[model samples]
Target: MFTPQGPTLRELAVQALSSVERGYDLLAPKFDHTPFRTPDLLLDPVARALRELGPYETGLDLCCGTGAGLGVLREVCAGRAVGVDFSAGMLEVARAGGPAASYVRGDALALPFGPVFDLVVSFGAFGHFVPGQYPDLFGQVRQVLRPGGQFAFPLPAPPRPGSRGYWAMLGFDGVMRVRNAVWRPPFVMYYRPFRLGDVHRELGRAGFDVALRALPELGERPDGSPRCRLVVATRRS
Candidate 1:
């Protein structure tokens, strides 16, 4: 769902027809007004969790659209906060918001920084990455973090197979696939592509010690599984 300030159906249709980067560029101005932005509910819990683990000096927000997660990083990171994304338009919106944070427009697969950050956080951006790219993505995140630094993100538990939400997501993914098949410069975003098991393995391979912290505020499913978790992957010291 979108707010009154969010993109119109015609605008959204045009974005869906463009490449992922270009679509986001077109959506950047109203990104924060859309449900597509990472929810503050999720951001708050992640900030609390990071605060418990941190007294971190520097933080980086990977693919920081409109600097929402950068706000979370600012709360927990003491010295400096940075946001990096490939979309110049998103970066421009982020700058206009005046997050007392530095911004960098760069590729996630080839991060430009050294081991300059104690923590890295990303929100709602993984869907943009195709399935086979996780290893490289994780590796790049690892490359920018100091030893013992963390790469954290919130991951919701998969929707129950027969649930309405599950069906909705399935349909969304199906529509995306159909769109990409016929469209040029395909917009790649699929809700179910990033699995926890695969993520854990890839993070491990990328030299991170992976762990999951339950976000208790979100409660648990009927089967007693955590509804959401914070994936905390620490680089080797």
Candidate 2:
């Protein structure tokens, strides 16, 4: 679901054919108009949750494409705020439209910073990282956060089994699997591997005391579970 100003079908096709970095670089200018950008509906709840948990001094947004999460950091963080992304094009656009904050071009797996941040937030970027890479990714976030600092992100509940959404996601992942198998410079984006149970365990392994906060603004499932949750992982002091 894209807007009229979003990337064209041909543009999206080219992006899909390119590597993730190059693809985002190509899509950076029109990214906010695409459904791929973290919508304000999701970002608002996350910002609310962070405010209740914070008064944080400095904040960092990991893989902050277009700097959507930077706005949340600006709301909750009292002092410095920063957005880091691997795509120079994305960072350039972020610096232009995003809130006043520092923008750094850096890979999420090898963050170029010290344990200086009090809070870190990411949105819609987890799917870019495969399961096996979770350890290194979480470790990098941990490495940049002060002890007792938080690494937070919103995670939506999986779709109901046999539902259209479920089938759609499964089909998308299947296509991606086939594409990666045959393609070069594979674009790693898959939803199946980023499960809550597995992520909680990995966060523990990465030395974070994890907790989930319900984002009631997103509503609940038919079974009464939160439709979305904010995973707040605090580094152990």
Candidate 3:
């Protein structure tokens, strides 16, 4: 679901044919118009959660595309805020107009900074990483965080069985699997596989004491579970 100003069918097709980095580069200008950009609906509540957890200094946003999470960091962090991503084009857009933060171009798996941040946040970028890469990604985030620091992000509940969303996600992942099997420089985006149970275990193995906070603003499911939750992973102090 994209806006009138968003990339066209042809543009999206072209992007799908390219590598992830190059595709994002081509889409960066119109990214916010697309549904791909992290929305204020999610970011606002995450900001509130961060505020309750901190008066943190020196925040970082991992894979901070257009810098929405960086804005959240600025709201909660009293000091310097930074956004990091591998895409120079995305970083350029991010630096153009966001809550006055600097941008760093670097891979998420090999984050460049040391244990310098008191808080780290990411938004709408997890699908880019596969299950096997979770350890390295978590490790990189841990490496950049102070012992008592937090790594936080909002995660929506999976679509219910037999729902349109459920089928749509399954179909999309299936398509991606086929594409990667036959294509070069695979896109590597899959929505169905990032389960919360597995994620909690992985974060624990990566030395984070994990916790969950429901975002009431996002409402709840029919079965009374939170529609969305904020995963707050803290490095052991």
Off by over 4 Å in 3: none
TM-score of each: 0.98, 0.98, 0.98
The deviation in Å at residue 106 for candidate 3 is 0.1
Question: Compared with the true structure, what per-residue lDDT tens digits does model 3 show for residues 1-237?
Answer: 257899999999888888999999989998888988888898999999889999899999999888878878889999999999998889889888766988999999999999999999998889999999999999999999999999999989999989999999999999999999998889989998899999999999999999999999999999999999999999996
* Model 1 Cα lDDT, one tens digit per residue, 81-175: 99999999999999998479999999999999999999999999999888799989998999999999999999999999999999999999999
| Model 3 backbone overlap count | 0
For residues 159-218, what per-residue lDDT tens digits would candidate 2 score against the true structure?
999999999999999999999999988998998789999999999999999999999999
TM-score of 1: 0.98
| TM-score order of candidates, top first | 2, 3, 1
Which structure is stronger by TM-score: 1 or 2? 2
| True-structure Cα RMSD, model 1 | 1.0
**Which wins on lDDT, candidate 2 or candidate 3?**
2
- Candidates' C-alpha lDDT: 0.93, 0.94, 0.92
